[model samples]
Target: MCSGGFAKCLGVSLMPLAVVCVLCNILLFFPGGTTVDSEHITQQVWYFGGILGSGVLMIFPALVFLGLKNNDCCGCCGNESCGRRFAMLSSILFAGVGVMGAGYSVVVSAVAINHGPQCLTKNGTVMKWTYPFSEGDYLRDHSSWSVCLEPAGVVSWHLSLFSVLLVMGIIQMALCAVQVVNGLLGAICGDCCGCCGEVSM
Candidate 1:
C-alpha cells in the first residue's frame, strides 16, 4: 500500500457505514410518522440531511482513491500523482459533513429522550415514555389526542445506535484530516522526509 492507502481504505469503509447510518436514522423516525408532531418532522429532516450529506461527501474521495490505486501514475507531488490533492480536498469536505452530523446527532438524542407515543394497556391505563416524570405521571397524562402506540425502549435504542454511528463518522473525519496533513507533508518534503513519502502505511 502507498502512503495514501490508509485514506483510501477509510474512504471505502466509510461509504457503507454512511449508508447504514442513513437507513438506521430514517427507520428511527418512521415509527413516529403517524403523529403530526412538528418536532418529530424536524428531527427526521436533520438526521436525513446530516447523515446523507456525510455519505455523499465521501464518494468523490473514494473514487479518487480508486483511481490512484489503479492508475499507477506519478504527478508533480509524488508517486501517486494528483490523487493526493483530490484526496485532501475530499477529506476536508467529509470533515465538514462529519462535524455537522455530530451536532445533529446531539440534537436527535436530546429530542428522543423520553419522547414516545402514549399507549393504552389492557388494564385500562395509558402511558408514555418521558423522563423526569414518574410512572404515575406517565399513566395520568395519556391524552386522547395521541394517535400512535410505540414502545419508548425501541426508539431509544435506535437513537443510541445512531449516536454511536455519528461518533464513528466524526472519528473517520479526523482520520481524513490526518490523511490530508500526511499528503501535504508528502507534497512539501517529497522523498527527503520518509514520513510522508510513498511508503507503506
Candidate 2:
C-alpha cells in the first residue's frame, strides 16, 4: 500500500476506538443515564473525566505513530531513513503511555457502561455496587446511604470497559517492547516483507 493509503487505513481503525472512549466518557457522567446528580461533587465528574477522556486520548498517538512509521527505516544516523527510525521510537513511547492510560480508562468505561444500571435500596441499606460518590465515602458513612440509590433506585456493579482495552493495551505494549528491543539491540529476524512490516508481534 502507498504511505498515504496505509495511514488512512490506520486512521479508520483508530476512529472506532476513539468513539468508544468518547461515549464511555459521556456515560461516565450519567452512570445509569439521567439518574446521577451532577451537582453532588466535583471530584465525581473529575474522576469520570480522568478515566474516559484519558482512554480516548490514548489513541491520539496512533496518528503520529502511523505517520512516522510509514517513512523508510534507517539503521544508521543521518541516513535520512533515520527519521522513520525516530518515528518508530517515538511511536513505541507514545503507544506505551497510551497502553497504561488506556488500562485506567477502559476500567472506568466498563463500569460506567455495563455496571451502573442495577441499583436498589434494600431496607435502610442501599445496595452496594453503585459508587457514584467519587470516593468510597458510602462505605464509611451509613448515613449517606440515600446517595447510593439511583433516583430510580438501582445498584450497579463494577464492570469496566478496561477488560477488553486492557488486553489490547497489553498486546500492543508487548509488540512495542519487541520493537524497542530490536531498535536497541539491532536484532534481525532473517526475514523480509519490508522493514517496518517485520512486526515482531
Candidate 3:
C-alpha cells in the first residue's frame, strides 16, 4: 500500500483509541462508578494524562495523517510532487508530538498503578483519605483491597482503568513511531507508488 494510505489507516485507528483514553481518564475521576469529593480522587487523574496527553495531542497527528492522502498543490504551487513531499515531511513532526504525548500518558499511568488509589482508610480511630496499599502490594492479594474503607471497590476500579491507559499509551506510541518512518518513506518516494505516471505527464 502507498505510504499515504497506510498513514490514513493509522489515523483512523488512533481516533477511537484517543476517545477511549479520554473516557478512561474521565471515569477515573469517579472511582467505583460513584461520585466522590474531588479531593478524594487520585492525584494522577488530575494530571490529564489520558485527556490532554493522549487524546488532544494525538488528535493533531491523526487529522494530519488523514489529510495527507488528499493533499494536492497543483493549483497553488503548480507542483503537486513537491507539495506532497513537503506535507509528508511535515507529518513527521506531528508524529513526534504523538509519541511524546503517549509517552507522558504511559508514565503517569504506570505511576498511578504503582501508587494505588486514594480512598478513605481507617487509621486507628480516624478515617482519612490516603493510599492504603504500598506500591503494587494490593495487586497480588485481593484481601488487601479491604483497607480502602470508602469509595467501594475503588482499588479494582483504579487498577483496571489505569492498566487500560498504560496499555493504550504503549499502543499509541508504537503507532506514532511507525508513522515517523512512513512519513520519511513518503517524503523520499513521492507519497504514492503510482505517482510516477502523473509526474511523467
Candidate 4:
C-alpha cells in the first residue's frame, strides 16, 4: 500500500484512531455517569453525548476500511446494494449525532469558562439531623436551613476531555459527509444498472 494514497492512508490511520475514540469515551464515562436535575441535566447530556457520539462515529471508519480491504466499492459489507443503502443510512444518523456531540462540547467549554465549576444540589431540609448539634445547630446559630449546591471538583480536566471529543466529532462529521455522497453515487449506479441487476462494482 502506498503511504501517499488517500484511501490507503485513511484506512490505516482510522483503525488506530478508532481505538483512541473508544478509550476517550471510557474515561468520560466516569465523570459523566450521573446526572442531577435542573441545569445539570443539560450539562451532563452534552458531556455524555460528546463522549458517546464519538464512539458511534468511530464505527464508520472500520466499516469503510473493511469495504475497501475487500474491494467492495460501495457497501460496508460487500457489493450488495442493500448493504450500501444501510451503510448510507447509518452514515446519515452517525453524522447527525456527531454534530450534536460537537455542539455539546462547545456548550460545555463555553459554560465552564463563563460560569466556572459545576456542582450538585443537596436539600439540607430533607435530612433529619441525628445529633442535637446537627439539628439544633442552625437553631442555635439562628441560621436557616436550605438547599445548597456544592462544587464537586474543578472542571479543567472535564473541559479538556470535551475539547478532544469536539475535534473527534468534527472529523467524524466530515467523514460521514463523504459517506453520504458515496451512498448517493451508489444509488444512482444501482438505478442505472437495474437491467443488468449486477450489484458488484
- The ten-residue window of minimal lDDT in model 4 covers 128-137
| Per-residue lDDT of candidate 4, residues 4-63 (tens digit) | 123334445545555555565455444434433445332443454444445554555545
Native-vs-model 2 lDDT? 0.43
Candidate no. 3 TM-score: 0.92
Score every model by TM-score.
Answer: 0.55, 0.51, 0.92, 0.45
1-201: candidate 1 lDDT, tens digit per residue: 354555567667766756765665565554433443444342434545335544555555555443444433244343555455555455445445554554454455444433433232232474533233222333345452233334334333434555555565565566556656655643444422443444434
Candidate 3 clashing pairs, residues 3+ apart or interchain: none
Q: For model 2, state the Cα shift of residue 87 in Å.
A: 1.6
**Model 3 C-alpha lDDT per residue in residues 1-201, reported as the tens digit of each score:** 778888999999999999999999999999999999899999999999999989999999999989887754232233554677788899999999999999999999999999999999998999899988777888889998999988998998999999999999999999999999999988877677465645557
Give the per-residue lDDT of model 2 (tens digit) for 1-201: 333234335444555665665554455455444544655322234454343444455566556545643433423323433344444445456655655665565455444433233343454544543335434444355465455554432223222433334344444345334434433332232112244444433
lDDT of 3: 0.90
Window of ten residues with lowest summed lDDT in model 3: 72-81
Model 2 quality (TM-score)? 0.51
RMSD for all candidates, in order, please.
7.1, 8.0, 2.5, 11.7
Error of 1 at 90 (Å): 6.7
Q: Which candidate is the best by TM-score?
A: 3
For model 3, what is the error of residue 25's alpha carbon versus the real structure, in angstroms, after optimal superposition?
0.6
Instruction: Give the residue spans of candidate 4 off by over 4 A.
Output: 1-15, 29-47, 72-116, 119-153, 186-201
Which parts of model 3 have CA positions greater than 4 angstroms off? 72-81, 197-201
- Give the TM-score (vs. native) of candidate 1: 0.55
Per-model CA lDDT versus the true structure = 0.47, 0.43, 0.90, 0.42
